[model samples]
Target: MVDLRALFSSNDPVGSAEAFTNRQNQWGLVATAIEDHLRHIADPGFNVEDLETSRNNVVHFHGVGGVGKSTLLRKIEASLTAADQRPTQ
Candidate 1:
């Protein structure tokens, strides 16, 4: 988790912005279950290798609305970006 309070300052807006950008690029926040689930699905052992192979590198998350779907996608995107992996559109 990030301490947004630390981002506020009476001075040094440039410095704060830089720090925030750096933290955004790095995985400074704690891991959430969504990230763990993505990693697990990517791992061949978690789901059968055959099943994953059949899917041809695809995964989907289905849930009711207002259940953090966008948040989950953003977290996954951040994780992939941190790992230098591009998320498919």
Candidate 2:
């Protein structure tokens, strides 16, 4: 559900290239899912849109113990890639 368009977008270019790119991609996934939330719920009339985008939106999913953050990222990436292959409206 992540808006693949947002993945290539960046509100901040004020950091290391690698880190910035990763952050942008991550947020794109989160935003996409969020934006599509209403459609996902079978409420066709309700829609969500992202208005204020910020550099601070970036979140590092890091931890020492067990967590599926990385796995989730990978899964999202794969799903988005597949979705992109489909024709867009």
Q: Pick the candidate with the highest TM-score.
A: 1
What's the lDDT for candidate 2? 0.48
Q: Could you give candidate 1's per-residue lDDT for residues 1-89 as a string of tens digits?
A: 43445434333233322332333322333345446657868776765645534543345565444334455556668656845566554
Locate the minimum summed-lDDT window of 10 residues in model 1. Answer: 16-25
Candidate 2: lDDT of 83? 73
lDDT of 2 at 2: 38
lDDT of 2 at 38: 35
Clashing pairs in 2: 2-32, 3-32
The TM-score, computed over Cα atoms with residue i paired to residue i, of candidate 2 is 0.29
Give the poorly placed runs of model 2, Cα more than 4 Å off. 1-54, 83-89
C-alpha lDDT score of every prediction, in listed order: 0.48, 0.48
The CA lDDT at 42 in model 1 is 79
